[model samples]
Structure formats: C-alpha cells, structure tokens
Target chain A: MVFHYPNGRAYDYHKNENHPSLVNKVNHRSINHNRSKTIYGNRGMSLEEEINESNQYYLSQGIAVIHKKPIPIQIVSVDYPKRSAAVIKEAYFKQASTTDYNGVYKGKYLDFEAKETTNISSFPLRNFHAHQVEHMRACQKQGGICFTIVKFTKTDELFILPADLLFKYWDEQDKSRKSIPKAEIEQLGYKLNYSISPRIPFLKGVDLLIANS
Target chain B: MVFHYPNGRAYDYHKNENHPSLVNKVNHRSINHNRSKTIYGNRGMSLEEEINESNQYYLSQGIAVIHKKPIPIQIVSVDYPKRSAAVIKEAYFKQASTTDYNGVYKGKYLDFEAKETTNISSFPLRNFHAHQVEHMRACQKQGGICFTIVKFTKTDELFILPADLLFKYWDEQDKSRKSIPKAEIEQLGYKLNYSISPRIPFLKGVDLLIANS
Candidate 1:
C-alpha cells in the first residue's frame, strides 16, 4: 500500500522497512500466519510500540483519545543560542509515579499501564511499583476506568486485568506469592487479539469489561 | 507556613528567597493585599506556580487528581556513569500538541490550559496556538470537559472560560479581532475567589460551570 503526502511524496506501507531485526522476526512468523491467515502478525514490536500504534489508529478513527505520557526529564542546564532554539545542555530522566497511558473514551476516563513478560506461566509482581498501584487505586475511587494490559510474549496472548483484581494479588506477595499465574489471569481478565490495521485491539477487551461491570 | 520533609528538614514557604527580582515583584503588591484582605497574596508567584500549588491542595484533599504534564524534551546524547544514573548530555524542547493539565473529576474527564496575561482589558489571541485550540476541540468532541483558566495579571483576577466560548472568539481572529475583552469574559465566564488554604480556588468556578451545565 502507498500513502501520498500533500507535498506529493509517496510513503510505502511495507512492514519492517526500517528495522532489519524486526523484519527477521516477522519472517519467522510467516509460517504460522500462512497456516492461519486470520491472525495478525505482530512479530518483533514491543508492547509499548504496538499500543502506541493502536492509539494512533484509535485517534484517526475517532474511537478514543488515549496517549502515552512523554517520559519526564529533569533539565539541569540550558544554553541560549544566538540565532536558534535554546539547547538543553544537561538533563536526566525522572521516575514517573503514575501509569503510562490515559485519556477519555465515550465520556469515561480511561487510565492504564501496559507491560510484557517473556515467562508464559506467570507475570512478575515486580513489574508494577507501589506508587503506581496507589495511583490506580485513587483513580478507580474517583470513578475512572483503571486496568493493566499484560502481554505474554512467549504465547503471544494479551489480557486486560482490572486494577482491583491486580491489587488483590499484589497485596498478597509478602504472604509468599511472587507472580500471577496465566490460568488465574485467564479466569479474571479479558483476553485480546490483534487485527490487521490496528494491531492490538485492546479496546475490545475494555468494552467487555465495561459491559460486565 | 513551614512543611517538614520525611528527612526532618524544614522547608520555608517564603516567597523568592532565591530569585531577588521575584521577591521585589511580590513586595510591590504587598501594599494592595493589605488594603484588600479578601484577595489572595499571590504577589510574586508565576501563574504556573499558583496553579501547581492549587493542584497540590486539591490532590491532598482528594478533591481531584489534576496534574500538569511535564514538558517534553528530545534527547540527543547520553552519558552513562558506571555506578550512577544515566545523564542526558544534550536535548531540545519539544512542542506539545495537547493542553498542560488533565484529570478525572466526579466521573468527568477534565481538560484545561492555564494562561496568564499582563493585559488588563483583554486576552490577546496570540497567547494560544492553533494546535492547542484543535486539541481542546477534539477533547470537547469526545464529551470531555474543556476550558481555559485565564489569569489577568494586572488586575489579579482569574476566570474559567468554557472552550466553546473560547473557540468562538478564536475563530473571529481571522476576521481582524485579536483579543477577547474583559467585559465580554465577565459576562460569559465564571469568576473564582481565593480561599485561605487553596489560594487559587478555581474549582469553585468549575462547580458553577457544572451546576449550570
């Protein structure tokens, strides 16, 4: 597929044109995709990149207004340029307290964080911070929709777990548990599948949660 | 007022001990505050600082969860110290497409931009950019509550103007009008009065807007 800019430049829509490693990963999945043409081939992309692309798709379709908050940077020094923009000479990345993505969908405030794990059996409890949990709890109390989108990279399965349910397992970690098993997540969360255009259709899982709630 | 940190250090809430010019500005307004005891003593603080302090008060009281989005920066180079955190060696400021503050309040998604102007009679249209207006419009279309908290620096008056009203004035700028007069704003917007603790009680204006809506 080809898209043309207003300036008449053509943009090729070929996959992994810029990243050879991503292309290699996609080629490896070609066998599985060839067997079942219905499933999406989300090969080498990180969960964050896939969600960001999904968000762009959502924005274009007027479905939602979600966005990843930019990483916060603590600026130390800036040099005033003689004939150009000011240059930040020194800075450092700052730790964030809340979740990654947030926005409004059909009058509901949506707040969520996305995480991925290689272990297919369970997701590590250490993936989330205490401050993030507190932030989600506060947002949930204010009637905002709060959840975590966890992806099992080994199995290529995604699930959206409610913040309250996540809190239940999180609070029990000190009692001897370390991770949330895949079976428990399957029982308590809504699973999502990728599609062609908007690769990660996580909002479908959100809809199910909303309907059940 | 003095705040004590967890480390047992006292933080003095005095104005501009570091910036002498800012202290002078505050001293210039001390005479006016003495005459009008009902007004807030926001003498030296920038509009951004006042809004941040107000947001902190709201957060502490669990009234709302509004937060200023950090300024985005484009990182160019980084230096990794062996035992310390990675330091950003070079970067540049990135333009933001959305407003500065947003949060969930009473099951409603609240989005707003805070702006201050020294102009006493009218708010200059140049204070706002085209992209920001588009962003506010998009949020409003999705049923998010959108507005602008404008501060008249000379008069020390604050008003919360609905985004729809702002759009009307903004669109007329192409027709030669460049500012929204104070009288017009007073007629269409909600004026907020400061209270003791939350120096800028702008949420009172939000309450009025909610009631009317």
Candidate 2:
C-alpha cells in the first residue's frame, strides 16, 4: 500500500512477514495482537517489545497512554523518483534528547527508559548515558514520574528503579562503582512481572509506586 | 564536534550558517542566545518555526516540556563503515500515528498541531487529516489538553482552536461545507499574538481557554 504524507510525499508500506501489523490481528496465545507477536510471548523478546505490547494493552483498557519516541534521524539527501515515492538516500540517526517512552497516566506525566541485561546479579551503570540522567532529572524537577525499567534476562525479572535511585548510583561512578546489584534494586525499586494479557504490566507497578510515594 | 549517542553511535554536528543553533547564540535582538534567529524572528517565517522558537522560549523559562515529534521513517538499509560513522543508505518517511507536537505542562499532558492558511476568510478543512482528528480525540479522552494553532497568514492572526470544535466542522464536511469562517473562529477560538521574548506564546491563550472551560 502507498500512503501520502501531509506534505504529499508518497510512502510505500512493505510489511516484513517476521513482524506483522499489530492492529487487531489476534494471536490466540496472547490476548493482544495490535503489534508484532515476534516481539511478544516470552520467547526471549526484547524489553522494548514487551513494553510496547504492554502499552497497547494499556491503551485498549484505557489504563494509560505511552509511546516510544521515534529514533531521531538527520536526513542529508533525498531522491525524488520519477512518478514514485521519494527515497531517503543519506541520513544519520541523531541521539534522542529525551527518554524512550513518555505519556500521560491518570493526568500525571510519565517518562521512562527500558533496558535489559543477561547479568543476573546487577544492572551495569553503562546502560545509561549522562545526558539521559540529566534529562530524567529535569523531568523529575518538573514533577513528572521518571524511572528506568531494567530487565534481568537470565532471571526473567523486571525492576522499575526510580530515576533518583539511578542518579545516586550514576553519580557514584567516579568512585569506581559499576552496577546496581539485584538485591539493591529488589530493596529500593518496584518489581514488575510478565503477564499473559498485558505482557509486561508496568503501569500496575507504577500505580503501586505512586501509592507508596 | 562529534557526540556519541547513548547506543554508542557517533553523530556529527555540522552547523549551517543559514540557521544558527537555537540553544544559545545571541542575535542582538532576541534575548535568548540559543538557536536560530531566522526561525525565531518575525520576518516572514513559517508558523512551525515560530512555534518551535516559542517552545524553546517556554523551555528556557521552565514553563513546559513540549517537543515536536520527529518525522517517523522506515529505514530499509544501513551501511556500517569500518573506520567512519554508519550511514543510513535507504529509508522512507512514514505517516505519524499522532499529532506533530506533545509534552507535559504543569503535570498536564499537552498535544497539538499547528497549521497556517493564506486564506483570510476561512481556514480550509482540507488542511487536516481524519487520522489527526482521531488522534486528538483519543488524547482528549485520556484527559490530555489537545488543540490546533491556526495561523491565518494573510492577517498574521493566530488562534488556538479546540479539537472538539474542529471535529464539529470536520463532520460538517459531508454537508458540503469546505471551511470554517473567520467570524466563527473569532467567537469560538482563543487568539494569540506575537511577543518579544517568547515570540509566539500560545500557552497564555491555552491558559485562558482552560480557565474559561
């Protein structure tokens, strides 16, 4: 299918069989089929995919509205084909100035980043960037709920560590500290588990965090 | 200078003398030293540029954290150079799933689209898409503040029209109505004017609309 952008540019939609459209395509195993199933079903899917599915579920249930920011790209050159779609010939992915996922939940602003590691013991500090930490701090200062969703791939455990806690560990970097231990996260952060319906129900985790605070 | 993305990809920062950085380069007239004066000044710039400068102004004042969503692109292929930066070789711009701009303001979710029309009598309904109106409805359902910043280029008048009002006129399309008259907008919409420091402070208009509602 070919779709025209607001500016009248043509965009050719070619679906990859591996990743089908998530809109109303039901996979019997999973309740949600709005997005790629290849990114769901607990068969070692990426944390981002899990969260995206969770977001779809949240939207369907009127729980929350969150979306991953599209990767920023700097387009250097574009080729206007004769009687066809324009092709971007030269571009570079620009670094995002904000976190991965952001939206409004129950009238409160939400901003977060999702990361995963095979290290069962701890999440390395290197998973985060200094600018990201600063961005989160800025959001936090503005009263937005800021956090990081860390997944332990080996153990299949997920933790929503508050940005302030992550900042504490981040600032201690020069003192030779490397990672936040699982025990520390288990103690200070809210743990999120995988579910069948929503896949990764982080909003419930967020609710609990909000209630506790 | 080169800045590496959080994912370890390098982004080359090249300055175009035509448009200076909007962050902090003084223009002798605008108070903020950051960003482009061409995009900021009142000398016949696009409405999008005016809003962008206003956003930068709002950000500098700690008023809001709204940002324009980057145009989504479907990347077909990328080249990995051994010694230099990786380059996107083929890509196509994709239709956005939501509006142009969104963010958090005073803990309230803000989402909006800006449009300009040279027609002085009425703002044409063809300037909007069904999907954009649907997106606004969804955001409004979630209690997010949603509206359109319409600029009548001929008169240089700006108005913040609520999405519901837009939907009404949009639905009237089947009745053979092609546009919303200027008087209707003057009665129903909140008008905004250009200012010195912030340039296009539409948020003040938004505040009045909220207060009236």
Candidate 3:
C-alpha cells in the first residue's frame, strides 16, 4: 500500500525498506483487529500489531489503559452518495506530532514510541523524529513516564529504553555515532520476553522504570 | 460535512442538529488549525475550535500536553498515481472507542470528552457513547483524571463535570431523566471563565478537580 505525507510527497514503503528511519509503516491490516485477542505464536505480526494486542490484553485485565493513537489523515474531499455512507474521495496522511502509544498506567501517565530494526548490532537513531523527541522531552518535564520500545527483529529481541537515555544520545548524535549500539541498550535498557497473554509484555519493564524513577 | 460510522450509517450533521446526543459534530475546520494561536474575541468559533486553541496555548506554555485524538477512519481503497501522492478513493469513519481529548497534566493522566448543547434546560446524557463512558470509567478506576466539558451554547456557559458525577447521572438515566439539569451542572460542576490566550481556560477547573480528588 502507498501512503503520502501532508506535503503531497509519496511514501513508498517498499522503496524505503532499508531506510534506517522507516519504522512503523502504517499497517492498515492491523487497524481492524486492534481489539482482537492475541493469536499466540504469531511471530509474523509487526511490532505495531503486537503492541496493539498487548494493549488490548492490558485493557482486558485492568492492568493499564494504553492505546495507539489513530493515524492522522488530512481529508480533502468527501462524497455523500444517496442511500450510502460518505466516502473520502481525497485524503493524505499527516505526520503525527507526538508518540504513538500513551495512556494511564497505575496512575502514572505513560507515553512511548515503538520501533523495530533488522540490524542486530544497533538501533538507528534516525528511526525517531525530531518532533517526537521534543514531545517526549516535554512530557518528561511534566513528570510523565516516557520511553521507547525497541525490537531487534532479527533475533525477536525487545528492549525498553528510558527516554532520558534516548535524550542523551539524541543530543550527542552530532558528536557521536548515528545509532545506539545493541551492547549499550542491553546494558541500560530492560529486556522483555514474549508471553502468551499479552505478547510483548513490555509493561514489566515499565514497572521497573517506575520503581527506578 | 458528512461522516459515516464503521457500519455504513451516514451521519449528516445538518440533519442531526436537533439530536440531543449529537454534541461534537466532527469539526473538520478545526483540524488544520490545531496548533494555531488563539484569535482573541472569536466568539463565533465552536467549542472544539476553542478547546484546540486552548490546548495549543497550554502546550506552548509548558503547562500540559493534551491533544485531541484523530478521527478514526477505515480506508477501503487508495489510488497511487504513476508519479504523484496517493489519494484515498474510499473510506468510512469508525466509531471512537475512547474519549476525544487526553494527555498528562502535572504528573497526572487527564482524559475528557467535550460536548455542547443548545438546549438551555439540560445536557443530554445520550450525547456520550457507551464505549466512551466505559473507557472513562476504566481510566478513572486507574486513578486517571476524567471529566466532561459541557457547554450550554445558548448562554455561552461552560462547565467541567467530574467523571464520577457523570457516571452517576449516566447510571440513573434508565430510571430517571435522560439529561442532567442545568441547575445540577451549575451547582456540581466548575464553571470555566474564558481567557484571552487559551480561549477556554478549563485547566484551572482541572486543577481544582485534582486538588479535590
């Protein structure tokens, strides 16, 4: 499927497969199954799909109230046909100004963005946007819990990195490397294991983050 | 403007003007100006527009990180031209499963739905969807701040009613009246005085709610 930015620039997912920053390509397939129960052992699912399933589990178990914000779209024109629903004739995807997943967790405001990389050694910093980093900074200042859920797709390994550490690397990117080495992530981040009920179960890491903070 | 629920039900705003439950009619006009500064003395603006302006003001001042979630739309088809951006050929609006506005404020998770009515006597409880109410209850149970922003359009009066009180009226609706009387809201809710920069300074009322809770 093809997507477009608000500026009318075409975003071809297939062409950007190797681009370091091309993560979370809008998965239209996952939209319809947002609240569906997790199909255990479905390793073929995208990080977004897993997160949505995990959020559904959290909601059902009364463990949290997180949700993935809908993709922002700019509709230019719509048609109202007789005896039928309105049809959006023209629309473009708008860049989101904030993180993707956020909600209340144990009375604390939780906000984070999810990213996946095929590279086994490091996670590219370019996968994150400047505006998203700025948004996380603002939320952190407000005392909200902020972090990034990084998945090494090659090994199916997941880690939750605190936003503070992300900010550290983000500010030093000009003077340092363009990515966070896997060794550094393993040293400072929390490693998550997949589960049958919630799939990713990253909130276990969030619990640790909350305890540390 | 016309919208459609996920079930293909056409929602015509002009035709539903008298529908008590039709509070927020999806103001497409406000989407583009989400981050724009408030145009002082613009009383002609809708409640949604004013709230967007207020959110912008709050964001700029580092007071809060509130935002309105994008309208959920299910895209059925898209056309990708040879060299141009993609155009949505067909799409339908999906019923939102949560409240409209949510964010972190002063280390607290804040959630709310905004509504307006021309009826001077009462604010109809039917204006809220069951899923939205259930979502709010879940958030409140998790200790997140939840409330409703009710506006009496005829008198230009606005009130911030806590979610607990809203649930009370909601539960009693089957046996009692279908609406919360204006007098009840005036007595139980916090009236918001409009401000120049934020347009609707509802956070001041939120501060009170936070303190009381």
Candidate 4:
C-alpha cells in the first residue's frame, strides 16, 4: 500500500524496504528477552530494558506513548563499505541537555530524567547536569509534567521526585553543601513500586501527581 | 563561583573554568557545537544553526523549551588514552523512532519532525521513516502538538505542516501505487516566513494552529 505524507506526497512502504524499514524482518522469536549482565544476575532485565518493555506494554494498552531518547553521540567519521553496514571510525560523546526520556501522557507533555545510583544514602543530584535542571524548570514553568526517576541501586528502591524539589535543592546546594537525605526524600517524594514489566513503574507517580494537581 | 550539585559535588561554570561535566579532561569547546556551513551567498545560515538560535530565543522569550534530539548512534569501539580525550573508534547509525524536535510550548506538549529538501516540486516522503509516522500518530493520539517543517532548498521556502495530513498520506502510501503530488502540499501547508535569527519562524504557524484548535 502507498503511504501519504503531510506535504501530499505518497510512497510505497514496501518499495526498497531493505535499506530502511525492516518490515520484512518481523521475525518475532518468543520474546524471552535476552537479559543483559548489568543486573548482576544470570539473566535478569536491566532497568532500561524493563522501561522499554513497559513502554511497549503501555503503547499496546493505549495508556501512554513514551520512549527513551537515544543517548546522543557526536560522530567524527564513518567508513562506508561496498556491501556491509557503515562503520563509524571516529566520534565523541555529546553531552545531553535534556532528560533521558519524554513523551505524551494523558494529553500532557511529560518530561523526565532517569538515573540509577549504587549509593544507598541519597540519590545524587550530581547525576543531573545544570542544563537538564534548567530544561525541567522551563518545562515545569509551562505546565508540563517534570520529574525524575531515581533508583537506589543497592536497595533497588525507586522514587519519583518532583523536579521542583530537585531545583530547590540544586539552588541551595552551594550554600548548604549537602545532599538531599533519603529520609527527607521518603517524606516529600512518592516511592515507586517495582514490577516485572515496567520495572521502574514511575508513571504511576506521574498519575498521582496529575491527580493531585 | 562554585555551583554545587544536589549530590554535594561542585562545578565551576565560569566560561573557561575547565569543567567537563562528563569528565575532567573533556573540554567545553568540544561539545559546544559544529558551526554549520552557510548555504547561499546571502550569508545564509544552515537550518541547524537557525534552529539552535531559535531554541535560544525560546529560552530568553519564555515562549517554549524546545530542543533538537541528538543524532542516534551505536558505539562499536572506544579508545581511552591516558593523557588525551577519549576517542570513539567505531560506531553505526541507529534508527530514530521519533521526530527530531520535541518539548514544552506554552504549557502544551509539542512534537515535530523537521526536514530540509532541495526539491521544490514535491517533498519526498522517503526523508521520513515509517516508525516516525507511527510515533507521531502515537503522540497525536495523546494530544501532543506534532508537525513537520518542510524546507524547499531552492527557494528557501519553509512550510509548517501538521502530522494529521502526514498520517493521511503515510497510510495511503501503503497502497500499491504512487506518491502524493506537490500542488496538494502548497494548498495544505502553512508557509513559514523567514526571519533574521531563527530564519524559519515556525512557532507563529504553530500559534495559528493552536489558536484554531
């Protein structure tokens, strides 16, 4: 079938599909997701993989449409072989100004930064950059859903902290010279329950935030 | 002045303060940005340069908090020198499933795909991917503002066209036939006027669309 464009142009999705869409590669093997080694288990899912799976589940359920933004990389060189995939020879890590994931949920723009820390005491605000904090502030000012998904690696405890709180601490960080305590977090923040599918289950906190708002 | 993070780590952001954010050695000038090549004899700024300037404008005017998503890349190899910047030795292009730009605009969620085409006759749907169309559909369903900025390279004409029309043609494109024509686009698209800084003043069109909606 022919797919039409916004500019009124049409193209065949099946034509020259090899170079672009792997529409033909729809080989769905039994989705026993190959769990990575990051989870410190033989075959447990990583936090990112669980989120991706949760996103898929959410998409299927029509509850929300969200996806993690790819980590930005600055490429310096690429070698195009005659018959194989192009190999990048030289590149650099590009600093990201925004959070790791964002999307539309329940008609509201959702913007967030996800982070995991091995520390047990406090979720380090150091994981976030000044620009991301600024980005969240801008989003919050305009009534967007702004928050962060913080994971305490050792405890495996996750919390959805309001960006407002984050910024507040961010501003006073220089004067106070201390991290936001986990006990303080437990009082002010909403603790997220983990699940097998969407491991982080942070959206539940967003729902709670919206309802309260 | 030392800006301390929420985690008690401090950073100095005073112009040339030797802050890498990512690492100690990675310099500020490295991630600053690539100066885009000027296109026309009119000292024409590239679409990228214009977009960055527009983002800056958005920040200053308090109109929006939009940013271009970084190019997705897959890292294959890396080199860590003891005394120099870490150089990525190999990588490959990873497919992007969403639009290039997305963020908060006037308390509303905004999502869009921007492309510049040299062909004025008919903008090619090939420039956009099927997954992106699906992504836009997903975002639109959630009430996010999604659209495409089509730039005709010859005349430097930029058009802000909504994704609804894009979806219509994208669906029809699945048929076993032809692409959509250019004349239909001229009628449907909102031609964007160029300006000194942002060049393509798209938010104006977005405002008109928003007001009507």
Best by DockQ: 3
DockQ of predicted model 2: 0.28
Off by over 4 Å in 2: A1-41, B1-41
Error of 1 at B21 (Å): 24
Evaluate residue B13 in candidate 4 and report its C-alpha lDDT on the 0 to 100 scale.
25
Q: Per-residue lDDT for B1-213 in model 4, tens only?
A: 122344553322223232122112111221222323534521444455566678778777888888877756655555655655556777666566677788888877888876666566877676677778888888888888888877676676778877877777777876732333567667876888777755556889888767766
lDDT of 2 by residue, A1-213 (tens): 122345554322222222212111111122222344446346644566678888888887887878887767777776666665667788876667777788878877788988767687888887776767877777777677889888776566888998878998898988967898889899989898788979988887788767765
Q: List, residue by residue over B1-213, the lDDT tens digit for candidate 1.
A: 122344554322133333221121212333333556455457555566677789888878888777777766666666666656666777766677677788888877888888777788998877777867888887777778888988886677888988878899998888868988888889889887656668788888777776776
Residues A28-107, model 4: lDDT tens digits: 11111332424532134445555677788888777788877765555555565655666667766556677777888988
* Per-residue lDDT over A1-213 for candidate 3, one digit per residue giving the tens place of the 0 to 100 score: 233444554434444233323345534234324524644343546677788999999999999999988777767666766666666777866678888889999999999998877788998898889989999999988889999999886577889989988998999999998888899889989999989989989999999999999
Candidate numbers, best lDDT first, in rank order: 3, 1, 2, 4
Model 2 Cα displacement at A177 (Å)?
A: 2.1
Q: Could you tell me the lDDT of residue A208 within candidate 2?
A: 70
The DockQ ranking, best first, is: 3, 1, 2, 4
Writing each residue's lDDT as its tens digit, candidate 1 over A1-213 gives 122334553322123234221121111222333446444456645566688889889888888888877766666666655656666777766667677788888877888988767787998877787777888887877788899998886678889988877898898989968888889889989898888768888888888777776
- Alpha carbon deviation, residue A62, candidate 1 (Å): 1.6
- Cα lDDT for residue A155, candidate 2: 67
TM agreement with the true structure for every prediction: 0.81, 0.79, 0.86, 0.77
TM-score of 4: 0.77
Give the residue spans of candidate 1 off by over 4 A: A1-40, B1-40
